[model samples]
Target: MAHDVQLEAITYETKEEVPQELKEKKLSWQKLRRYDSLDLESRSIPGHHHGHHSKALTRSLIFRLAFQSIGVVYGDVGTSPLYVFASTFPNGIGNNDDILGVLSLIFYTITLITVIKYVLIVLKANDNGEGGTFALYSLLCRYAKVGFIPNQQAEDRDVSNYELELPSGRAWMASWLKSALEKSMFAKQILLFATMLGTSMLIGDGVLTPCISVLSAVGGIQVATTKVTQDMVVWISVVILILLFLIQRFGTDKVGYSFAPIICVWFALIGGIGLYNFIQYDPAVAKALNPKYIIDYFKRNKKGAWVSLGGVVLAITGTEALFADLGHFTVPSVQISMCFVTYPALILAYAGQASFLRMNNDLVKETFYKSIPKPIYWPTFVIAVLASIIASQAIISGTFSIIQQSLSLGCFPRVKVIHTSTKYEGQVYVPEANYLLMVACVAVTLGFRTTTNIGNAYGIAVVFVMTLTSCFLVLIMIMIWKTHIILVLVYILIIGSVELLYLSSVLYKFDQGGYLPVAFATVLMIVMYTWNSVFRRKYHYELEHKISPEKLKEVVGGISLHRIPGLAMFYSELVQGIPPIFKHYVANVPALHSVLVFVSIKSLPISKVPVSERFLFRHVEPKDLNVFRCVVRYGYTDVQNEQEPFEKLLIENLKVFIRDGFGLPQSVLSNGENGEEIMDVRQVEEDMQPAEIEREIEAVDKAWHAGIVHLIGETEVVAGKGSSIGKKILIDYAYTFLRRNLRESDDVLTIPHKRMLKVGMTYEL
Candidate 1:
């Protein structure tokens, strides 16, 4: 029978260089949809994508999807204008050399950097629209040569041996490498970059968003009343920021449903205003499409051109996150939404503000109200500020995701990553990542005291990621694209030039506290790269020293300890070496009457604990002590060593432990609280007589069923024994009864078993 392909991860790398034995197998990467699920096609769920909906409904659906993407992807850039001008002119948006320099950077920043580089070049390199550093690296690793794999393993000393049996072994090798590399290397790098940059700007945004956004909003309140103080504005903004932090616990799952609709309204307001301005003014802002104009802005503003780099790079503040979070909504949706609604509204707001500044001059009074019609302005300001706040949520969420990816790739320490969406494999929430980021963000907020000062720290992380991406992509293009050297150089020149410009701009912001984020970024990069190098060396040295397979088999054949009384379980990693870890554990704590389980756990990008993959009893006696076996699961991050989970699973498998004289039970174990114990005998003592009258000599349990008991303990884990308590309920009470009946040739109890008898029931037949 065919299994669900949706649940399977197919490898994409070709097997060309591998031996003929491994050649028949194909490897394809994950092809999960934006919202992949087998059940979404059902007719019952309300507000589903389709189910006899009208064209108006369809438009609304598209609107909701598109608008959400805008809030998620482009919010940071759209909100930049709020603080960019203020930072350039501390007193006000006055026309100083710095002010014009910042404007030139901001204007051309949107053109040469954001439009020409990101949309026209980088986004096109997406792996089927799934972005992120890991996915890209994985695609690269698929084409990586195999000599890399063997050097890491000691068992492959004779390379010719792999030529004899390579296919099944290749599968096993891929599994181990993916696990180690992703866990130790990939995640840390991703997280370090996110934390250093995201945390810094977030702090800046936190301090700045409340004061700037609310002050701008409350300043609008002055049009209604003549009395308003800066003190009052600060108080109100502080209250709003507190409220924002307070809501982080509820998670965005429910909030996401409500958010999509409101975002549509917010964008509609901006779009309506933008279209109106485009019609009335025939705005020449459209001239931003020409990269030459951006070049001219830099040339004309030569003296402070370096300072302008940070401001220009602001247009691409959230680009790294978009690539980092491409695992969420589809790239088409994010890009389309940005182009149609988010970008248009942001441009209109900028143009409208420019016009207001032109007409009134007092519109630059640190109050956002003087720029538009009073009634129209108040409502629009409310929506715009609210949209900005929501946009911060994506940044926060993306920060967590990036950190998680970094940790997985071995760039950082092991931190928890939680998946928020049950259906979406990519929707994650890391509490450790979240709190650390919050700390960083708040610190920056306090340090900067205003968004204007904090805005400088914003573009560093994305620039680093983008610069690294360009380097990596250049190598890949040279390897894969077959492009001419001149063309490649031209591409690198365009990318490098813009990157250098941004790097210089941000350098100006350093004294203003931009170094804080850069410093953090540097620390994370060091830790990730350093730890990975150490781990690889250790693992390589350990595995390489292992004995050959012939020696291992000889050792296994010579063991006389099998007759020892106890269940001996081996801790099996099933890697290149034999099960020596199990032997070490057994030698350390040789428990008597025990069942040993060699355990193997498989974890996917998705988080659900797979139950069916659990394997069961194989009796492997070191010399023949009747050792029962199993492979139990305690989840991917469970800290219990091999002995603990296996012991617990063995205790639960007690019926099988006695039934097949201790056989395996896969299905019966997961039936209920414990599982439906096999309805059979439980209490047959072992017959020691080697000469029975033509009878099977194995001792069997007359299997009895045990009922499940539930309890929650109130205790906290002190560091890493994982949980202090693992509850085990009664799984089977009758496993020993049937065997006794069969031995005595007595009739089975028909009445007591009919109603599902509980404990303490005494009925004499």
Candidate 2:
């Protein structure tokens, strides 16, 4: 007999006709009946609204986006002029030779790291249109089965952003490399560890960028007047930092509108001043552009020049922002803004500062303010402060984005993610992360009280992240790009050697504040590792013990089960079959809802999943069973809707699937009455008018009006009976404690309390 025939043979019993033993076990029906009289006419879920908007990319739109990219993407590197010279040369400039050498190093570092490595190379490694460490890792996973999640489906590969095309003739090597990585569990674990370490370091950047940028900018107040002490600078910076974080909930779309113009003026002012100083003070300072001066500087002051590379690294402090912010702005937009506006302006600004220092070596510490032609000192100071705030805003927003990606990929604990803009999906705000970052920023400002110390810490975080990026980029070049071996080696050696040199210089100052990022990364690494390990273990445990659909049907048919009037949606992590939690619930309750839906929400390796392609549905057995499964997918950059919108969209899709049988054959729609064929699904769908579809929806609405309950499994993980003590402490104690303290599943699901049914279960892993 066919599967459909088997399903049709089973008869569903109404609630009143249920056996007395089953009625006694069906305790939840009484609570569900309380909603029987409630209104179901309103299709909207409370507190849920669909406000997402998409814009077209017209010429005017692209230009506008490119212009906005200036303020958000280039602010940190643009403001490097304020303190780079001061940080590099703490004492007065010894001679013209030292000035040329430091300037040469700064120029080359910016050109090599910022221009060639990032703008030209790293930007191409973006995952689909998205960039960042997580984005790169996501792209790598597409080429190899290195993702932590094991339940990935074939349909997941059909997502828009998961598309990857190798060169016409290099398919064999790509296939071999992918196979090798997938076959080894150890390799996958190592890849995840490296990616998580890079992500943690970027989070550390969020804390340090604001502290250094604001402190360095506000330090101008002390230069303008001897009465303004370092203590005053610290207080002012703290106030500014507080204000910057306080308005984060408003989001980047509003905050970023004014950033472009303010930064435009700042760049023009710096560039023009640089040109003026280079001409009037010392035109010969242009000699710093020669690479020979870099060699001569290192030769002249071997150890001193090496130590000063830490400060030179500051020139590219926010280089990662260029790539990370790709989801917000396009590659062409960022590239244009950097090459045309930001790059030239920064180079000129640095050249001007060097020229000023060459002529007036006594004012080395105040090179930026002193170099200003005096007429625009106060105005320039105000612009500098605004520019620094803009830089801080950019990184804070980037930090929020990274955390959201981490949560979706199961590498971070769940936190409330609020989409702050309707126009841009990537514009988001996390209240908890925002406040925590603000507190860290204030502490750093007060503790360091000087750009010198903060810059040391900032340099270490920046270089370490860059090095990790280079490491990931090497694999991307070979496995994805399929580039020639010689070319890959050249790319890695050049990028890796420079980053390591800077890394060594920063490490040499370990006692002088360089340990801050190390400490920050260490703590974050622990959190990420613990959360991900526990999550993976639980998933594997569930996968090993999942009940097949055939077994589930057998269990249901073995008993005379009662079908209640409403829908019951069960959320599970597994993509196929029934989770153990469902079996556990049915055994205890002995009754099921009229409609059963197993919803599996999975995150795909893409930036955004289109609304039309979000839900995939299939029948678990047949229509008579009222058991269906839905696999709803989301991209890392996608925002999850609240309950009302989610429920509305789900029911709408379910109706379409029912009407069309999701393209099933006409024979499959025949009723089991003497094996007679009923109306064909295609014929019914073609004959149905809008009114009939609306009426079908109305019927579903009436059933939902009775009440809808969300069944979630609350599982406790512990070591198996035969496990070692080390495993017991890690799983039973540490993992359990963290799970208790972190955000609960209810908070993430946003399920209404009155309509929720949690089934508790324990897993010995």
Candidate 3:
């Protein structure tokens, strides 16, 4: 529908300009209230508006993407085979009558949930080149454009000079920008915070998948090779764990090419093996495909059936990762990959495992190795092991991506994020994320003491994630697709009910120790959520609401404000006792140092500008001395890193701050000559409640020293704060990129010049 509408710049007569933000207050049902999926800024990548691209192939991107891709995004879900079969069979599908029941349940679960719900439905919801919660939340905030009140929202108290530049590429950019200037900053920020919580929870799941899969696989190996002690299997799992961690500092871009084809072959072998077995016992389990099997299994062995659902739920373990990693592959590409490669391979393997169970006619704790010949078994085992390794890679990659994304959206504390190569968008690395995963994975390998135990603990967190995702899906189908309430309700009820049944099984296993993971996830969620709240600082804009645009334009239009000859104006840097720089303006050279105004501009953290007017003229604080101080408050938020906008804002509201240099009340700017020192500003409030004048004075002092923004180590104020070294990791390495671009001499250290600036902050989280 928007394609037909040309992208013409809208012009309004000051009368009709209404100075209004273009937003829709449509009562379209319950007001969809723009979610992460619907935001305009997040709707496309940097080059994507006209074309497309990831911002840069930097080390941070490599670490982030790789970890997420391997850890949470793809790995966990891929390695679910360890217990998928064992737990699903024997009582659930082990017997003749029940074989069909278990098989049918597994078959349908994959087809509907993994294939349809994941590959088709959930993955399609990705916003632009990014996916996951924070990315989605950003998109929603950008597009919703609900509350806007001029400059009132952008004036944050901590760092009062940040302004976000909204790209004018989408259908509602202008409207959203206007609304953002007024209100709804908190709502959008809240969503971002929630999204971060989601990412952290997602990553915690990563440490468990490989531990469970490899552990389960190893258990089977031990069953066959009794000569090989369980310790040997444990050692093997540990070694693989070690290798996975070591390679993380680098990325799989070069090695990843080997990933696809190898994984493909692995799946093919699985599919072929499954097909062979299915045909042999095809008749025995044919009845399993029917709905009656589910009913029968539930009726005859209710408790067992419930227990088995835990294993059944394992089939779709990585469902959420499918959506989280949507940024890695385009919608069509991921869909194709899942349908043509991932899905078939998984389904056939499950079927093949079922056949093996039928033929064995017993509780085969060693399905993966025992179902086949010894010579074939070893090689097949190798293939499956290789597959498990690949699955691990995927989980690692996914975890990296989610955490990196969390940092980008300020959901986590700033960490050392490095993109792997300038050429590959997929290659990313995060020192903090990598080290943490490595530590957690190692802990996972050792803590549970066995993969079998890990398996019991693995499915719970994923179930929680899956349930939340399902809720989002229901919202999309109903809110965006506008499906009938009844239909949406029915779909949610059905999916949720079935999911709960499976979750119950896992929950039952909690005492068997599944609660360990759930507990871990809960803690992670808390950290992520808390940090976002505490460390979230908004960049403040020094808006000049006192000055009228009309008055400022008059001067640029040749009208005169005073007898002052030159434009020598000092903004509210509020230096104590007039620095030598300003003295230069008054002393020796002694030119007409007139037209000085210490303008104080207040800005809101998020855009919450009022839609009705451009600026509030009422509380317009005016000053009386030769230094006329006028203050304009803005509500715009989410903008970071830019030159101070004091001069520009002053021009916009000249009449409000300007005063005839006569006897009058003294006005003090937040950062003015008269401003006094107070306490250090840790971080700005996420809500942008204007900080006290005392904090502003301190900010000016820090600004005078030209302090570097601490991306890392300042986690006391950020969500999911990483190591102080996290920021150091990026800053230290960033110099390498810049050094590579500059002349390198043995006598000098090389790096991103930004890092060279001396500061008190610690490096390398």
Best candidate (score: lDDT): 2
Ranked by lDDT from best down, the candidates are: 2, 3, 1
Please list the C-alpha lDDT of all candidates, in the order they appear: 0.43, 0.77, 0.49
Error in Å for residue 267 of model 2? 0.8
The alpha-carbon deviation from the true structure for residue 261 of candidate 1, after best TM-score superposition, in angstroms, is 2.9
- Please, what's the RMSD in Å of model 3? 15.4
For model 2, how does the per-residue alpha-carbon lDDT over 1-765 read when each residue is reduced to its tens digit? Answer: 000000001111111121232224333323211110011111222222222223456877778878989988988888889888888887656667899999898888888999999999999887767899988887777667777643223455444445565655666766788789889989888887888888888999999999999998998988889999889989999999999999998878899767899999999999999999989889898888788998988888899889999988998889999999988787778888889998899999999988888878888877888899888999999999999999999999999988888876677766778788887668878877899899989999999988889988999989988998898888888788888779888987887889999999999988999999888889888877777777777776776688876787776555577778888889887655567888888888888877788887777766777776677776555345667777677878887745228887877777666554342333434453454333333343455455654664555666577778899888889899999988888788878877888666766777788889899999999
lDDT assessment of candidate 2: 0.77
Q: lDDT of candidate 3? A: 0.49
Error of 1 at 284 (Å): 6.4
Q: Which predicted model would earn the best TM-score? A: 2
Lowest lDDT sum, 10 consecutive residues, model 1, at 28-37
Instruction: Please report the TM-score between candidate 2 and the true structure.
Output: 0.87
* lDDT for 175 (candidate 2): 74
Per-residue lDDT for 172-238 in model 1, tens only? 4444444554456554344334433443343333333333343344444555566865455445555
Q: What is the lDDT of residue 406 in candidate 1?
A: 46
> How would you encode candidate 3's per-residue C-alpha lDDT over 396-506 as one tens digit per residue?
776766655454333344344455655555455666667677777777777776655666677676776776677555544443344556876776777788777777788
